[model samples]
Target: MEPHLPTTIQISAPQHAANNPYRVIEGEEVLSVAFREFVLTAVAAGWKEPEVALTLADIADDYVMALARRAAAN
Candidate 1:
């Protein structure tokens, strides 16, 4: 697999953060998939910007650790 860059999620407004105006650019397939899942879950749960940000960051960190393990197995 190619080296994957981190996904980019821009939250323009924190106070009135909705699912519509967010800018998401997933640089890698797996990262993109994980990111989408997190965002969807957050949206469904009606989470605000801070909570969503925390969850996304946690997901990204977990993803990187998983990737590292996979790489080490090769």
Candidate 2:
């Protein structure tokens, strides 16, 4: 595969982000950039696409389950 720069995803709701005290707008942007860099680095270092996808899904699943557990507790 030809080498290309990883793209950063732009946050669409900067105003809403600013209104939310729990999440900083700049922090989200930085995390996105960092995530892209990590993915690019992983691919460059011989990680397969499936592995990367599975990792992402696992992370998302963990987050979702944590939320679910919190809701149940509440």
Candidate 3:
């Protein structure tokens, strides 16, 4: 019998801030997928820039929900 294998994932942020002043803050999320796919999605979705500049609390709920959905799928 074969045992189930766990999925290994990692997320990271930029080491420093972006140079763009329009970006109140800059960071990144690293997913374990094909580099091309990741870059394409980020570029197409325009998630590379901050959509809104607000406190972390403002987006915490939505972020948590997103994390939950991703976790559930895995």
lDDT of 1 by residue, 4-48 (tens): 444455433333234634323323444566567767666555678
Tens digits of per-residue lDDT, candidate 3, 1-74, equal: 34434433344555554776534333322332433354444445544424322333367678999999999999
In candidate 3, which residue ranges exceed 4 Å CA deviation? 1-55
Alpha-carbon local distance difference test for all models: 0.63, 0.74, 0.49
What C-alpha root-mean-square deviation, in Å, does candidate 2 show against the real structure? 7.4
Candidate 2: tens digits of C-alpha lDDT, residues 12-72: 4454455677568566776687677777777776798779868987998999999999999
Best by TM-score: 2
In model 1, how large is the Cα lDDT of residue 15?
A: 35
lDDT of 3 at 4: 39
Per-residue lDDT, model 3, residue 71, is: 100
Ranked by lDDT, the better of candidates 1 and 2 is 2
* Clashing residue pairs for model 1: none
CA error at residue 13 for candidate 3, angstroms: 10
